[model samples]
Target: MDSRFVGIADLVETPSVAVVVDVMRACTVAAWAFAQGAERIVLAESLDEALALKARHPDWAALKDGPLAPGFDMVNSPGLLRSIDLAGRTVVQKTTAGTVGALAVKGASLVLCAGFVVAEATARLLRTHECDSVTFVVTGEDGQADEDLACAQYIARRATGAGTDASEFLGRAAASRAATELATGVRQGVHPDDVALCLELDRFPFAMVATSEGPQMVLRPCAATSPTDAASI
Candidate 1:
């Protein structure tokens, strides 16, 4: 299958598979939630929609970040997801980039969220399917370079059988604005551990794919065993 690294504006025309990336944090948090056995994750486009979903399903956990309303169960932090026991609980997430990008794609039959944590496994899952082309959606770009672009570049390379080894990509991500802010205590409500977790390559042996149920975009994991797999750092 062919692979192309594109921004969210190109979301309209995707092939059989589209992997949305927000490696700075959103997809990282979602990956950890799945790793901790979340039943399924819902992506909400707005705070009101997320609150409405929460009102309907009171048992489900609601998470939000990036200037959303304050009723969410937790901030959308990967560090927070690390400590939660989310087994069988539905996760409703609202974020500026990741959730929005994941939900905006209308053409692809399958949409998977990508981060360094699940990079290789996501690529492996893509290979299992018979696709003519795949698009890696980089959500973090805002007229400038960002970590999500770095991640999408890496995943696209690996998905199209062009490369292996994540060191170079990881370095670029670590030096990106998001990682640097967290490392320097410039980004509030975020910890260094969260950025650290996001940079660890191939940490999860699964890919998080977004599927629609009615009007909601719910995410589920597709797992595979890896020789280099380690659950935690």
Candidate 2:
């Protein structure tokens, strides 16, 4: 699928590769988890749900979630995630935006997860697979424009591998715009580190997928397991 703009509602009918973008947090965390050697990750839409999952499997997973400002065990800081030991461990994470977006794309034909951190890799996956269509679902802020749109702009370019025109500039433009938004008062607390984190390209080789186990949504290694093997993660 060539890169194109899309909405959260449109995700239901899109018969193509679905790349869920939650740049500020969720997707960023997924990339970090993979690099940290997390065997898999689970993205729950709400902190309460994520906590319950952790309670049920206390011996097997590490949990993280909470409001963004004070931060949580599963804080959205990309810097902190790098120091944690995740190899062979399962992570149950909850966030305000990204995980919710993953929940919405649960039934996509090919639900591939993405964010700024893996833009290059995401593009590679698209070029190699060349699916029927490509939809960049921006889980907007409270259903309004937020950092996800900027992240989506970058992913859209990567998914199509389009170099001419502004395809190459969308990501940079998005980040610049996000910076502008932060400065102009439309958005606040937009971290420079986070904006930079979202712009990093293809730092890892894997894309994440949201796995469903009953009512829970978890981010898992897309290449490592099938949906039927949800219990194993």
Candidate 3:
């Protein structure tokens, strides 16, 4: 099998599978939302698209570029979701990096979103799908973010059956520039708890896969194999 890593600035060639990583919150939040019983997630490319989605599904949660809107149930922060109940509801998400990266890799046979939460599941899925070539896409805001790169490396290593160390990977990601900024930006509405949550590796046992339906990118959970089964891959 062949695997390659591509940052936001680099153009990605469609491989057998495209694994998009956004460790600093966006993808992490999506995993948490699904684990919390969200029906499905609709990822939009822009704030206007998110708003239009909200207009169509008034009961669903809408998240744009900034803080939680008046009518929206939650923002992009995983910490914010801790206070809300998303059982059987849908979420419309638009972010500067994660969702955008997910939408960009349309040429791949499969597009999966990866974060610390779904790293193991992602690796198992690639092995199960028998993907000979995989592209790891890091959704960095300015060329490359440490957290995203770290997550990409971790997933690649795990998928390739290399020596895997979850603690070391999480430590590197937690100390990244993006993590530090979010942890210290409480006044800017960035919560330390949110950063903490994003740093937790393999918190969920499912991978988020994006499938195109008409003009929308729909995200759903893929049940992962057991840790023992994943390690044997």
Candidate 4:
């Protein structure tokens, strides 16, 4: 690993792990999907691909397509996902930027899904390693704004033993400007409340992992050895 930077789609090779982020919607949706009891999420970079996966497993799958225009199954929204029941079922998701962003780093040596919700767990994951370098790839945002950059900086600070103050970092002028932009029109498609939900740290302990079965993303709820015992997070 050589250098670490914000932004997701564009990244170079490294011997260390790469933290993939889709903060605006994808990661948030994944978090909610798990919270609602989804067995797994198959993240496809393309809508057609995700649909195809559903076609293969129609008996037990549903598709959530990102907002492109109007003729899609579902727009990437955590609220919409929350309203549905997915217990013991799987979700096939396709997002314009997030899913594609994850696929972009398919060749990396180590790739892990991340967002503000699992920031502490992400820090813990980083603590378990001692590589020469680590990169947190913040997808969708081009690094000109605070959302992804703030998250990237947060991860980098964790990796380097530096302090992380999220609100302060996001309170900068540039970030405020971006917030204005997001409010006016460019990012109106995103839900502010859901964004806040995704930023909450450590509501779950499971790290969303991509596997052959699908994107097995969910909180592996603590298990109690016996009926009288309490479960731990």
Number of the top-ranking candidate, with TM-score as the measure = 3
Model 1 over residues 62-136: C-alpha lDDT tens digits? Answer: 888743346678777787678888888898998888888888774569788989999988877776765568877
RMSD score of candidate 3 (Å)? 3.9
Candidate 4: residue pairs that collide: none
Query: Model 1 Cα displacement at 194 (Å)?
Result: 1.2
lDDT of each: 0.78, 0.61, 0.79, 0.57
Estimate the lDDT of model 1: 0.78
Q: 1-233, model 4: which lDDT tens digit per residue?
A: 23376565356553246677665667767767777777666766565666666667774444453343432345566656667777767677776666665666655555566666666556655655554676666665464545666666676676555676766544442244434554455654455555455556556665554433334322222221221221232
RMSD of each: 3.8, 4.8, 3.9, 5.5
Order by lDDT, highest first: 3, 1, 2, 4
For residues 142-180, could you state the per-residue lDDT of candidate 2 as single tens digits? 434545666666666655666634334445535554446
lDDT of 2 at 134: 75
TM-score of every candidate: 0.89, 0.74, 0.90, 0.75
Q: Give the TM-score of candidate 1.
A: 0.89
Off by over 4 Å in 1: 12-14, 66-69, 224-233
